[model samples]
Target: MIVNEWCMYCGECAGVCPQCVIEVCETGLKFDEQTCEDCKFCVMVCPVGALEKDEQK
Candidate 1:
């Protein structure tokens, strides 16, 4: 997943992630690629369209 500059730092994506791969804090958001299951839940839950699938990968 890719988080762009538009990210609002909301914790919604982290809360809805099924794989527990996303972590949101006061600093920023962190994505654990090792634990991610390619589940698009985070992408879907991001209200600001900050998260997206890394299509180039």
Candidate 2:
């Protein structure tokens, strides 16, 4: 996923992820890309619209 500068670090995305691929850290979010299922739950739940699919991947 692509986490933009608008991210608020609310942990909403990480909470909704069924795959548990997203982690909320002090600095930012970390995505386990290899384990991701491309569910986009994180994208949809991001209140600040920070997360998006990396189409280039």
Candidate 3:
């Protein structure tokens, strides 16, 4: 899980995340990749379209 600069920190993604991978950090939602299963649920649920996968591949 990786919350980029696009995140509004509204916790919108957190709600849909089954693994609870999204957390509100000091800067914003600190995405914990350790618990992430790449389900992409958070990405779809985000109203602001904040949450996203690394997509480095």
Reference-based TM-score of each model: 0.84, 0.93, 0.74
lDDT of 1 by residue, 1-57 (tens): 888999988788999988888988777888888788887988888899999888775
Show model 2 residue runs off by greater than 4 Å. none
- Candidate number achieving the greatest TM-score relative to the actual structure: 2
- Which 10 successive residues of model 3 have the least lDDT summed? 1-10
- lDDT per model vs. reference: 0.86, 0.90, 0.75
Tens-place lDDT per residue, model 3, 1-57, is 555667777777778889987787676777677788888988898776665588772
Give the range of the ten consecutive residues with the poorest summed lDDT in model 2.
43-52
lDDT of the structure predicted as candidate 2:
0.90
Better of 1 and 2 by TM-score: 2
Candidate 3 is scored at a TM of 0.74
Highest lDDT against the true fold, candidate: 2
Preferred candidate (TM-score higher): 2 or 3 = 2
Angstrom error of the Cα, residue 46, model 3: value is 0.9
